[model samples]
Target: MDSRSSDVSARQERGETGGWISTPVTTDLLRGALDLEHTEHGALPHRLPARARAQCSDGQLAMAEAQPSGVRLVLRTRATAVELDTLPTKVAYRGAPPGPDGVYDLLVDGHLVARTSVTGGNLRTVDMTTGSVETRTGPVGTARFSGLSAEPKELEIWLPHNEITQLVELRADAPVEAVPDRGRQVWLHHGSSISHGSDAASPTTTWPALAAFRGGVELINLGLGGSALLDPFTARALRDTPAELISVKLGINLVNADLMRLRAFTPAVHGFLDTVREGHPSTPLLVVSPIHCPIHEDTPGPSVPDFGDFEAGKLTFRAGGDPAERAAGKLTLNVIREELSRIVKQRAAEDPNLHHLDGRELYGEADTAELPLPDRLHPDAATHRRIGERFAERIFGTGGPFAARDD
Candidate 1:
C-alpha cells in the first residue's frame, strides 16, 4: 500500500474522531447549489429546487442536476488535515471499461492544494444501445486531505462534476465555521452539457468555474447536461435565484435533441428571457448562441452516438438529420444563432441590459483545428480553460456586459 493509504488505514483503525471535530453540512457552507435534499445517507445537493425538479421527469436532467457540477463546501478553519465522507454514485457503460473514480479537489485560500478520489461507492451500469440501467449499492468512502498550512484560512472542497455525491460528514482537526461572504458579484449561468463540464479535468476547472474565478464572482451553475432545453421550470428557477450577472448558452442541446423547430424556437428563447426579466429586469443578461460545432453547423440534428469503436472503448457523436431538413424549419446551429441575435437585438431596444454573444467568439473554426472536441460534442480540459478565459475577457473585462461598476 502507498503511504497515503497506510495513513488512512491507520486513521480508520484509530477511529474517525481521533482528535477530529465534526461540522454539520448546512446551506451556509455550500455554494453553487440551489437546494439540498436530506437523504437516507446524507445531504444531496440539487441545482434545481424541488418544485422545478417535480415539473420535469427527464432522467438525464435528474442525473445532471444531481451531479453537483460546481457545488463545493466552503468553510473557515485552521485545520492542517480534513476529511469528507461521501457516497458517490458513479456511472459505467456496460460494454466499456469502468471509468476512473470521481475526483475531490481541496483548495486552500482559493488555490488548489490536494486532489483525491474515493473508492467502493454505488455503481450505476448503463446499457447505451437498449436505454436501460442497473444500479448496485456500495459502501461510503472518505476523501482525506492532509499536511496543510494550519493557519486560519478558507478552504473549499469541490465535489466531482460528473458523479452524484451525497455529502455525509465533515471531520477536521480544527473547528470549522461558515466563511463570511466576500462581497463578490453572483453569476448565475445556464446552458447545456458543454457548460455542464462533461469532460472537465476536475470540478473547479470546468469552464463556468474557471470563468467565475477569473471574474471574481460567486457562481450558481445551472448547466444541466442533455437538458438545457429551455424548459419553463429552468427559467423559473433562474428567475427565483438571486444574481447580479446572468447568461444562458443555448442551441446545441436543442438541435442535438431535435426538440424544436424554428416556429417554436424563437418564441421559446423570448419566453425564457421574459421569465428571467420578471425577476431581474435590469441585471446584465447575456444570451450566448451555440459554440462552433461543425457537425451541426448547417445540418439539423438528433445527434446519435457512433458505436463503431465500442469494442475499442471509444464513443463519438454524429448528426443524424439531413441538411435538406432546413427547408422544413428544422433548427441548426447557424439558424439558431441568427434567431438568437435577432431576438436579442429586438429585446435590447427596450431592455438596455440585454446583450447577445455569438458562441463562436468563444470557440470558432480556428480552435477546432487545435483543440478538436473529442466526442464532437463536449470540449476537452484544455478547451474548457480556453473558453473560460475568453468568456472572462469578453463578458467581465472593460466595458463588457457584466463589467464591474462603481455606484
Candidate 2:
C-alpha cells in the first residue's frame, strides 16, 4: 500500500488519542449543502439536490455545482489539532499551464486562522481542441492544522471552493460533535462566475461568503460558474430549499454564452420566478441584473478567450459579438436590465416581497474605472470585497429589503 494509505489505516486502527473519536464525514456536519451523494471514495456534497440534478443532463452544470464553491464542514470540539482526509478532484487544461493548487481554509469560532493544501488527490483533464474529458484516480491525502486553543471551539473547515471534493474522514485529538444551528437567517443566492468567486484569493473571500459574513446570515450559494442559465431545474432547486431571503444575479452568463435571444428571455424570467413562488409564496426575493461589464454593456457576446500572454501563463477574454446585433434582437446588459425591471414592477402588485435592484447600482461605471475586472470577465479579489461590502450595506442594512420585519 502507498504511504498515505498506510497512514490513514494506522490512524483508523489506533484510535490515536485513547479517546479521539474518528468521525465519519456525514451530511449532518456539513453546512451550505443541499444534497449529499455517496461515492466510492467518500461522501460528495452537492449544491443541487438529486431531483434537480436528475432533471438535466448538462455535464457543465453537474461539474460546476458539484465543485462545492461555498460548502464547509462545521464541528464543535476542543481539539487543538485537526486532520481531514479528502480526495479532491483537480482540473487541468490540455494546452494551457497547470491550474493553481486548491486551498482548504480553517476557521476557529468563525475567524479564519489557517490555510493549507493536500499533496495528492484526483485529476481531471480537459482537451479544448477535441472537446474531450478524462479523469484519473488518486489516493486520498490529509490536511492538518494545529496550535488552536484548547477551549471548546466552533471550527469550520471550508472545502476548496473551486475543486470537486469527496470528504473521506475527519480526525482530531478530542471528540467532536456537529455544531448546533445558531438561528441565523439563511440567504440563498444564485449567479454566474463572479458570484462563484472566479478571481477571489480564497474560498472565504468569495463575494457570497463575504456578504454572508457581514450580513449575519447563513449562505446557500448556488453560484454555478458559466452555468447560471436560468434553467428550470435551478429554479426548482431554489423553490424547494428554505430561505428567509433570496437573490438572483442575471445577464452576463446568458450574453457570454450567447444562449438565447430577447424573445425567449422574457418568458424564461417569468417562468423561473413562477416556480420559486410556488414553494415560497411570501419570502423576500430580489432580482439583480448584471454588474458593469464594459464589453457586454452595449455589445452582444459570445466571448472568446485571449491568449496573448499564453506563454507567460496569463489569459483573458474579449467579446466577439458585434454591437449591430442588438438591432436583430440580441441580448445585451442594458436590454436585460430594462426587461428585469419591467417584469418586477409588473409582478410587484401581487407579489409584495418581490424587488428589483439594478446591477449597476452594485458596481457601476464609476467603480469600473477604479476596480477593473482582471480577466475582462471576472472581478479580482479587491473588487469582490467591494461588491460584497456594498451588497451587505444595500440589502441587509436599515431600509434594505432584508431588514428585520418589525411586525
Candidate 3:
C-alpha cells in the first residue's frame, strides 16, 4: 500500500474516530531546522544546534538564530481543518513603536493558499542607544486554517521569519504524517541580513527561498541578521550540516559590523573555509561577496541608524566609519571583494569544486541605479526578487556553479 493508504490503515488499527489527532512534532516533520530545543512553552526551532550556539554568547546571534528564517513544518494529511498553537517573540524598539505582526505562510500541495499571523507572543524591547534589553511574557496564539481539501496532500506551514516561534501544539481533523522526501538536493547558505529576509516582503519571497524554489532544491538558511561575522561556531555549524551545495555570502557583515581588520579577516576567511572543507572536502561550495551597498561600497563602516524619522517608525542606516581608515587596514566592500577574489583563485587549484561569485553580479551597479536599497543597506522586496532570479539564472542555470552533477 502507498504511504497515504498506510496512514489510513494505521488509524483504523488504532480504533480511531474521524476526529482530531494530536501528532507529536518530531525532527522528521521539520525542514530548514538544524536543531530543535525544548522551551518552557514548547519546542523552539533553531538554525544552529546547541553545541554551536554554546560557543557564542552574542544576544543578536541568539535572537537571529531563533527567528526561524527558513524553518517550516511539513506533513501529509487529509484534514479539512488544521490549527497550530505558537508563542512568537515580537520585537519592539525603545523609541520606535513595534512593527507589523509577523506572518505565517501556509502552502497546500506546493501552492500558497493563505497567509496568517497569531495574536499574542512574547515581547522583547531594545534600547538601541543604551543597549539595554527587556523581555516580557505574553499569551499564546493560534493560527487556524480551515476548509482545506480533504484529499491526502502535502501541507507546509512556514513559521514567522521575523519572529522567534515557540510551537506549542498542532491539531488536525485527520491523521497527519511526515511528508515523504522527494530526493531534492539540499542547498545550505550562510549570509547577513539580506539573506535573512529583513526587507523582503515575506518568508517565501526571501532571495534564498526564491532561488531555492527556482533551483528545485531544499534550503537550509543560516542567514543571521547583523550577526554573520565569520564566527568559528557558525563555521562549525556549516561544517557539520549535510549539503549538496553550499554558499557563504561574506564581506558586508564583516565590513558593516566593523568587526575585524583586513589583517585578521584574511586568516579568518581561510580558517572558515578550512573547517568547512574538512567535513565536505569535495562538495560544490560557492563564495559570494556582498551585494551593492552604496554607503559601504567605498566607505568603511560600523553603520549607524539614521533615526531621522523615529516618530514615523522609519529607521535607515548611514556609514559611520571614515574611509581614511582603509589605509590603516580597515575593511570596506571594495577591499573585501579584491581579497575574496584572490583567496578563491589561490585555493581553486587545490579545491576545484570551490567557486567565487562577486555579489554585485547578483545586484550590481546597474541594478542599484534602477532599484536602490531603501535603507541604504539591505535590498527591498523588488530587489530581493531581482537578486533571487539572477542567482537562480547564474548559479543554478546550465553550466552554473550549482548545476546538477548528473546534468
Candidate 4:
C-alpha cells in the first residue's frame, strides 16, 4: 500500500482520525533562531531576542534579523507529506521589478529533497534612493512537500533567508515530533548580507549553512545583513547563545554604512568581543575580516546604490566616500582587515581558544576575476558554494582551529 494508505490504516487501528495532524510551531521545532515572538498570526523567528531588538530602532536591523537566514523547522515523522503555512514579507525596489520569490528548501535526513516558494503574503516596497519603505498586506500561503518514505525520518524545512517569514502552521499526515539531539557541535556565526544568504540559491546553500553541513555541526546563523555593525546587543545575543564554536565576520557593513571611523571601529570591535567572551569565555571563537570587494578595498564607503539600470531592473553599488578620507581615519576594508588581524593576535596571546581567519582566503582578488559579484557587492550563488567549501577545509579540517579533538 502507498504511504498515505498506510497512514490511514495506522490511524484507523489507533482509533484516531486520518486527517492531517497539526503541530505547534514552537522553539522545540525551530533551529538557528535565538528567539521566537508570538505574533498575531503565528510565530516569527528573530536572530536577536526581544531585549536586544528593543535596544535598536533601525528598521534595517529589524527586517534583517527577522529574515531567518539559517533558520529551519526540524522534526521526525513517518508522514509521506508535509505542509507549512507561512506569511512571507518580500522586499521590492521602488522602480525595479520585484526580484524572484524567496526559496524554501526541504531536506530529508540531511539531503536536499525539494525546493519551493510561497506566493501571496506581504510586500515591502523600498525607495532605495530615499531609504523609505511602504508595506502592503497579503494572504498567507502554504508550502507543501510530498512523496516521502513511510518510515520514520528527520525532516528540515529551511525557511527563506531573504524574506521575513511568520510561520503560521505545520501539518503532516502522520504525527511529528522534535528530532532528538544528534550530538553535533553547534556553530554560531555572525556576519553581513553575504552570510545572510543574499543572492544565495537557497537557505541551506548560504555559505555558513553549507559550511555547517560540511563540518557536521548544527548552525545558528546571526548573519543580519546590513546590520552587522558590531552592536553591543548583538554581541550579548551571541554571548548568551549556546554554542561549541563561534565566528564573527566583520567590516563590509561598517564600511558600506560609513557607521564609524577607525577610532570608533577599533574600540567597538574590542567591546563586542569582550562582551561575548564574558559568556563564552573559552569557546573556539574565530574572528574573520571582510572578504574582497574591490570598490571598498581601498576606497571608503557609504556605498550608494547605482540605479542607472533601474529601468532594466538591475541594481549595483558603488563606493561614495573619498579615498583621501582614509588618511583622516575613515575605515576601509584593508584597514579593517589589518586591525582585525592585530586585535586577534593581541587577544590570542592571552586567550588560547581565540583564532583568526583572513576573509580573502575564502574569496580573494584571484577568485573575483572568474566569479565576479553580480551586484558589485554580494557574491553570487556559485561564489557562495566556493566560499562554503573553502571555509569547511580551512576551519574544520585537520589542524584547523575548529578541528575535532581526540578527547
Best by lDDT: 4
- Cα lDDT computed for each candidate against the true fold: 0.92, 0.88, 0.90, 0.93
Supply the TM-score for candidate 2: 0.95
> In model 2, what is the error at residue 189, expressed in angstroms?
0.8
The list of candidate 1 runs beyond 4 A from truth reads 1-17
Angstrom error of the Cα, residue 158, model 3: value is 0.9
Write the residue-wise lDDT of candidate 2 on 1-407 in tens digits.
97456766786786653555578988889998899999877899999999888988877788888988889999999998898888888988766788787889999998999999876688888775465889988878888888999999999998888888888878888999998889999999999988888888888999889989998999999999888898999999999999999999988999989999999999999999999899889999999999999988889988877777754666778888999999988998999999999999999999999998898877899998899887789988899899898888899888999877678
Alpha-carbon deviation at 224 in model 1, angstroms: 0.4
| Order of the predicted models by TM-score, top scorer first | 1, 4, 2, 3
Q: Is 3 or 4 the stronger prediction by TM-score?
A: 4
Residue 220 of model 2, lDDT score: 91
Q: What is the lDDT of candidate 1?
A: 0.92
- Give me candidate 1's TM-score against the actual structure: 0.97
> What is the lDDT, from 0 to 100, of the residue 173 in candidate 1?
93
Q: What lDDT is obtained when candidate 4 is compared to the true structure?
A: 0.93
TM-score of each: 0.97, 0.95, 0.94, 0.95
lDDT tens readout by residue for model 1, 1-407:
74335546878887753778988899999999999999988899999999999998888889999999999999999998898888899999888888789889988999998999989779999898998989999877889998898799999999999999998889899999998888999999999999999889999899999999999999999999999999999999999999999999999999999999999999999999999999999999999999999999999999998998876787789999999999999999999999999999999999999999999999999999999999899999999999999999999999898889889
Model 2: pairs clashing at backbone N, Cα or C within 3 Å: none
